[model samples]
Target: MKVMRILLGYTLLCSQLCFGQSKLHFIVFADTHDRSLGQTNLKTFHDLSSSIGFVNTIATYAGLQPNLLLYEGEKCNPKEIDQLLTTLVVGKDDVIFFYFIGHGWNNRQNNYPSFIFGNAYTDRATLETISRNQYDIYRRLISKQARLTIVIGEACNKERSDSPPVISKREIEIMSPQPYDPLKIKALFRNWSGGFLLSSCQRNQFSYSDLKGGWMSVAWQNTFTELCNDTYKRKVDWQLFLTSVQSKTQKTAEKNEQKQMPQFELSILPFNGSTPVSNIIPKSNTPVSITNAPCPSIDSYVNETALAGIREDLPLLHEMYDEIDSDNAKEYAGAFGLFFQNQRNFYNKLGSMVFYEATGIPDKCRPTFDKNTKWVFDSTNEIYQRISVINKYTSNPNKLVQQARSDLPSIISRLEEILEKFDK
Candidate 1:
């Protein structure tokens, strides 16, 4: 009995140690103190923090342990980053996700951007002391040889350009309300093994952002949310996932009348001496018919509830625009206040509506739905651009407001036309 007890104790200890070594490590590094892009950087950190929490929850559901470390604000400096990289310890089976968002510029020497860790951009000494290339960071992390390493830098890559580039929703409300599939989550975080690098924009391009968040970061989060919520996909295709993120990022940039093309490099290492291409590619491309799919309900909701909601709000928008265009300052102030509040809700609703239409609707309606959704997104982005301009307060506020007001009528008309087509 004593010998049997000893054997059992050894077995449990081995199991515990093995589990600890295979844990996932998620690290976020963000410079949230830059004078120009401070607020946008902070928003990105909050959004990503929420995303990390979601990942932790899913990891726990899959019976895996995840460790998260956040270095932001004043703590996000070069010394700390280097120290962390130098002293970090990783396991062979561990997964590492490192993300950095801040003001960055390319030197025309390396493909990656150099992060400006110092907030005092005017101080040449400070800038030189704090700036670090993302390629160096990637190399140090990959040298640890964890099962998988993902390095993402979401910042402008413009060479010698002056422009500085830049979530949680109601927490659980924005994520899929349904129960998550543990196996799928495991497949995504655990099954894959490789080093993946992502940049928000290509060479000589400026990554764009607004008061909400960086367009690239928003697109990345949205794509991940959709993938996590999709329980019907037979396999998690990392290649497709990256492609979708790239496409969404570009589309969002174009909608805002800007240009940003995200670039990514993915290398899937061999598993057990077998090729990793099979793992990267899904076994099939056909969409799986989800059991008890919400297609019909979504169709009805989009055609009835969503469109009616927009129609009801259009009159108020027009009224606010009239008041803003009026000569009275008091009326303009009140109208601007109402416009800000209403536009936020309206934008959020349109975003949710488009997500549902894209994911839940049947294939037959996809063509028309795609066209309508594009129009809606593009118009909303136009309004968003005006809002951003007014919010910046860097120029004459009244002139910007008037310009936005001037463009409102045509945008509203197009929205009304889209609504008519939807009704039909």
Candidate 2:
């Protein structure tokens, strides 16, 4: 009877402890457009997609899915962001992961950094007008039952003066709302728990991007993917992950002849450590696509030395096609051969302008070159579209195969014009 009584008492205690445990949640926002750069919107769109994949991958591994993932284009304003935050009910046992990717700037007047989104504030708006009541949402989040919070800012503190002229206008400056001081915020929660702030770059430094996406985005994705793939299956450590991301971002920046490095600030309750990353992540058999096949290095397409690297990679691309052909993978080989062939043909067709585009072209010819390249890229993208169609069609019916054959001649004719133009 005593043993039975003890067991009953223990079971109730276990139930209470289990019920009190907090779960993990995430909130992600990528304000990809503010009009400071001509390509900022497009870049941010790509970044947002990548961010979604990163978060989703982690959640899949951890077992718990994100509570909310919000991506805003031109319509996301401060009020809208606050409203979204209000929807979440954070608990003391829960951990919140917040991510922002866009232009960021330090408001000297306010002594805080802000992330700029489309319609963040009017051009003439002062710091007080833009940042007023903005950070209260974050404050409210931590003040509640949440035990840990992570904030990742993939934004620039200043407009990169060295960014290519083709990317942005000289007249516009896109910046984020000033962020709440990390130390101060941590102090507020010092007795309660801990929070981490990961910034893309240090103060006075600007973040960078290429056609692929922002370097910081690439770094985070890479680090997370590698961690997931690690053989040890060890617990996830933020410090270790951040260190790896910083290294990767710095190397990428240096290779592109840019200077940008990620930075972080961590403050958490010093008591029993927070949850092990492995505790949240589950084991999965499927491989992550973002980490498995990364986007081609875009920096190689952006500079003279990098252009040479692209040229050197052409043979490898052809080799990839040949390997597929050797395996009698005709359907895939055609797509592979055409995709790289189109990329090479497009670059060669443009000639010295590729270099000029990466560097600086004369103002007179700049617009013309930009127009031509855009046309070239659009047409080349069709090859990728066909590849997708080919992938979807099965061999049993082969109707799509016949359609692709019918479309080939027109595609050839369009490609031929570029050669003809070169000959002229």
Candidate 3:
């Protein structure tokens, strides 16, 4: 009888442990690039500025104790980034990985569309020191049997100021080869899973950041921190999690005056919507297509365009417009556009509301800094810069993916449903 009781107790304990475990697991990397090449020295790159602070911020927010991280030139070998992935090759679970900083590629070559690790310094032994392999990370993630996965990149293959005036004819195609002989190559996803990837800049563009105190990437890191750390609650789905991240990130950036953009890809299967987002938990699997902006992308576009090639994005702007019916889309365009044109008046009302909402100090939160009140606006320099980059569609600078501020009314109406659903 005692043995039977003991066995039952053990089983119950195991069940509860599983219940409490977050569904998300992810690895993050920041400022990884030619550690040897820079206007800023290695010392600058190594500091724990706002960039790294944001990284740690998100880790804390997600209740995530990052298993491993590769920063700058230290743990940047392609192979080193992937070693941990080998252990997870068979686990069909959603995992998140982030990479930010500089990127280098054989720009002259038309071979595989792969970029070089930014540690442009040619020190082989230092490079070969074993760590995790990025390839294994990709493999474990792309496995269909894997749960779900998300990979976000905040690097540009080349500097935006240096990119050609033309967007590359090539599509951002990183889809792993179709399942051929799963018996041989076990990493691709067609057989079992889902995921997405978000990149700061496009194929021909460069992603850049104005380091806070000349250390680390700030804008990119802030967005991740706000989304994953502050706003995330348990039970939220990936789409909403992404939406919140994109929105709050901009707000955080704006407050700090950091300018840079952030982008991402999400998976359809793992994207949970149709209801207002209330919470978030960690995930496991692949990536997906993104949904609407946390705040409309129009405001960000206005500020972004004024900043030269330092454009940004908030997911695919066109896709957000496409979410509603055609009639609604047209209506939204006109209304949203008009509101932005008269933003001065709108700002006054929003500012007052925010003041009353705080019921405390004048400087505790910026207008947009209030995470609890969604109606008021969030306007800070860092938010604007982050939005500018994400809203820039850095991948296709020539293309205008945002609804001009002049077209916001209709856009807001179109968003009415989603917003109301969120209120519920």
Top TM-score prediction, candidate number: 1
Which regions of candidate 1 are displaced past 4 Å? 1-20, 50-52, 124-126, 165-179, 270-424
Clashes of 2: 16
> What are the C-alpha RMSDs, in order, of all predicted structures?
16.5, 21.9, 21.4
Best by lDDT: 1
lDDT of 1: 0.64
TM-score of 2: 0.47
lDDT of each: 0.64, 0.49, 0.35
Q: Output the TM-score of candidate 3.
A: 0.36
RMSD of 3: 21.4
Expressed as tens digits, the lDDT of each residue in 1-424 for candidate 3 is: 6995675456445533532342334454433334323322232345322355333433332333333344455554556555545554333333344443344321211111133443533332332232222223343455523354555544444421243222122222111222121111111221223565555443444443332312123333333333333233443345554555455444444444543333455544522322111112113221211343243222211221112111221122344444434345445444333322323222233323223213222233335444533442433222333334433433332232342332323333433332333322
Error of 3 at 234 (Å): 14
lDDT of 2 by residue, 1-424 (tens): 6995675456445533543344556665566565654255456555444554544433333333346556666544566566766777766556677777666564321112457644533442332234322123344555554666777776666422223222312222222223122222222222235565677776556777655566776777666556544242554455667788899888877776668888775555443445433222212111222333443222222333223333434454444433443234555545544553334333333333233224323345446656655755565456445534544443422454454454454444444543343322
State the lDDT at 307 in candidate 1. 56
Tell me which of candidates 1 and 2 scores higher on TM-score: 1
Report the Cα lDDT for candidate 2.
0.49
Alpha-carbon lDDT of model 3: 0.35
